[model samples]
Target: MGEELKLLGAWANPFSRRVEIALKIKGVEYEYLDGDIIHNKSALLLEYNPVHKKMPVLVHNGKPIAESLMILEYIDETWKDNPILPRDPYKRAMARFWAKFLDEKCVPALWKYCWSLGEEQENAYEEACGVLKILEGELEDKKFFGGNNLGFVDITANSVGLWIVVIQEAGGFNILTPDKFPRLCKWAEEFRSCPVVKENLPPRDRLYALFKARFEKISGSKDAELASRH
Candidate 1:
């Protein structure tokens, strides 16, 4: 057993899940504390992540680490068993490339596709597919992004599927329909079947109801505000 590891996370966030999945893969014992950084965050969150003031701060041995990718590296380094990073130097670099790619480039268009409601939404919808096309190409012949068994890239890439499903519902489009991205769709099924991920996931139907309610609430507010102008 090691010193206590605590994670401050938002349930719906893929950024947070990146760290969570790494922790689970490492078999490190940790306590997860959920928060709504959108409103009031925990005192520990503020103290631990004074700089970023963000959720998904990983506190290990009372020291805090921020940023999902950085925290993952820290976890990998701290725990020798069940390493998340591939041993090969080139593969490690490629893994980080994909992780950063997800953090930077992939998320924005995905968000816009789910939330935008015009030509802008249409453009972002296309952009999201373009990004998925790149990913599908990368995964074409690979078992996982690290090539054999699960590694950092596999976890990070699949974390985005949470967003993909949510976006599919929000945008009224099935961007990841099994027929279109068979590999990805199959990967999603297998990934979720993993005990750590499958057990940790919020119940799908319950999550759907919560997301639907929030989506309708926000959209209704926007409609009401727009109508008041006329």
Candidate 2:
């Protein structure tokens, strides 16, 4: 029997997209099941990931794996064609470190920066910029966070590359401008240009419209909250 590989994912979620990109890089074929996580969660998605019940759940030969980062590592190990992680233990650990940082630190800050208004937005912008500066330094003269190729850290940082662009444009925030983050902007350009990445990415216009409406809702609520406090 052939390998039974399946991916439970949402089309617009960056986390889900990460797994898709990794699978493409490895030339792995899998069935794509839309979780429709926002409106309605699929039974298979819940069955596979009861704990978090999130998207990008990979089921391989009856085994289910959750979390995009963990799923990416699992794909790399199982396929062993296009290696995503570093061969050296130390390097692999470092790549994990940066990936964690991007998710735990950078992504949240960027979200706040895009979702808030007035003083809160300013504070969030500063916080996000500080995180971007650290990433800029980490990138240095390298072509990618994983050095010459798109690897673990690079894949993990997909939100910074593509999602953040839509978020910024939709929310009218200049938090990740080329003037302040030249390296990151260049890196994002490079990442988006990759053949696998280019093909797998969600339509930019759809993402922009989604984020724009979401940002409007967030800002509207924040405005109401402030008005009530006065």
- The best candidate in terms of lDDT: 2
Per-residue CA lDDT of model 2 for 150-229, tens digit only, reads 99999899999999898888987687889998999999999999999999999999999998898888878988998999
| lDDT for each residue of candidate 1 in 175-214, tens digit (9 for 90 to 100) | 7777877777766776677777776666667667766786
- The TM-score leader among the candidates is 2
- TM-score, candidate 2, is 0.94
In candidate 1, clashing pairs total 0
lDDT of 1 at 5: 84
lDDT of each: 0.77, 0.90
Q: Name the runs in model 1 displaced over 4 angstroms.
A: none
**Model 2 misplacement above 4 A:** 222-230
lDDT of 2: 0.90
